[model samples]
Target: MAIGPSAVERWLDLSTEELRAQVKQLVAARLPGDHSVWQAIRRHPALVPRIRGVLSGLAASAAGSKDEAMQKVWISKARSALDQEYVAPVKAARKPVVKEEPVPEPEPVIELKEPEPQQKQPHKAIPTMLFQEPS
Candidate 1:
């Protein structure tokens, strides 16, 4: 029988151990976002680490799976949940940098310019063929 969103509570209703197993199987079937579990996960994000564990196991299994690319998609989905579905981890606040006056840039040490062309001069060879007599 096809399960609907309204029926999700029935699926989710189980003992703690049973629920974990069911959630594992559900995540294995598809992305957590594709199911109502995402809503529950949003409500109780402590489940993220467990989900991540399952995803990591899935990633390892993907190595031997014929559809490795598809398995990578699951990994992407897991990362997306961590990045987008929840608040980011707290980062250490950076200390304010002391303001220092800007120093003027220094002039270049070397300058380059195109070489000037030299004027053509007549060569003093063979007296410029002057007084050309019989060869």
Candidate 2:
């Protein structure tokens, strides 16, 4: 239920001399990224080291505090501000074009031949009707 200053408010509260000292400490620690406090640094995101130093100092002070949960909340907010600061945006990626190849047609494997139909011959008449009677 404790209310406190925001990260921007805390940063803005620092005296010029204190900010300069923090920036120097960051440089001494060989922290990467921009340490300058200029507005231009906000656009391209180069001021990480400077603010990170401030966060470190804040953590040291909060370590001995009675309210550990509140201190963690404050630190989380400050970190969130650092992470969400102005920076160069990522560009959309484009898909690469793929070339198509022509496929060859396959030849037939098995061959079959069919026989032609033949006409049927007529049957010869029998001579049974010409038999002579024995009188």
Candidate 3:
């Protein structure tokens, strides 16, 4: 069955539990070996329902075809739908993007100064005498 925008919107309106259930059903029906998708659904229990309609539609479409090629095609379509509807959008939303402008380097400045003449200090002569025996 073809999933339209309205169907997706309706799925988006479903409760978290309902969505989770829908995804669980889809996993059981169409993706038994897809542990990663199952793990992701469990991890983001809240997000699973968001793609329920697409996945459900894909699963339904794949249900009629017993051909291995057609089943593979449906699985691929479901995977893409899950990525587009759920994974990619969430990843994009969660990514922290920092936009920074390149700053221009500052030019170095050098200053020239004249050297001052050194001042001579008067030196005191050391006391010649060793301490006289204290009288």
Candidate 4:
């Protein structure tokens, strides 16, 4: 059967590259946005490469139903993304410390208190424990 106008129109509306780009963008956006989907996609051993291939192929294709479906999926993803507010985590502001007022200097009072000289004590020899009797 020949391709219908609606199908042709949809395909004409979005090129294969455009569709692929849409899918890639959607995946990128959703990967970070949705934890579950991202985890699932990441946890899947085979899905990762297959998904990459599919998305890359979708992006590279010039015309196909897959591309059209991806375009719609991208549109839905875009809509959901638009509805949410993208707020970055707020950082704490640093506060400037206030300087304290300087106090007046006090008058110098001289007090003579002589320190006693220290007496030298006799040195004692330390006892050593020799393992080999000091050969």
Quote model 1's TM-score.
0.41
Task: Tell me how candidate 2 scores on lDDT.
Answer: 0.51
Candidate lDDT values, in order: 0.60, 0.51, 0.53, 0.49
Question: What would the TM-score be for candidate 4 when compared with the true structure?
Answer: 0.27
Listed in order, each prediction's TM-score against the native is 0.41, 0.33, 0.25, 0.27
Any idea what lDDT model 3 has?
0.53
Q: Which candidate, 1 or 2, has the higher TM-score?
A: 1
Identify the runs in model 2 with alpha carbons over 4 angstroms from their true place: 1-17, 20-41, 44-46, 85-135
Where is model 4 more than 4 Å wrong at Cα? 1-29, 62-135
Cα lDDT for residue 15, candidate 4 = 49
Candidate 3 lDDT by residue in tens digits, 1-135: 222233333544667666645554554456533344544553454555555454556556566566646655645655654554333334445768799999998988978889899999989889887777888
Clashing pairs in 2: 34-46
Query: What TM-score, to 2 decimals, does candidate 2 have?
Result: 0.33
lDDT (tens digit, per residue) of candidate 2 on 68-133: 566556556555545655655579799788787878779878767676677787887776767789
Per-residue accuracy of model 4 over 1-135 as CA lDDT, tens digit each: 122223322332454565454446545454443444433344434434444554546444525664676655654453453334434447989999989899989989999999999999999999987687565
lDDT of 3 at 135: 81
Q: Against the true structure, whose lDDT is highest?
A: 1
Which clashing pairs does model 3 show?
A: none
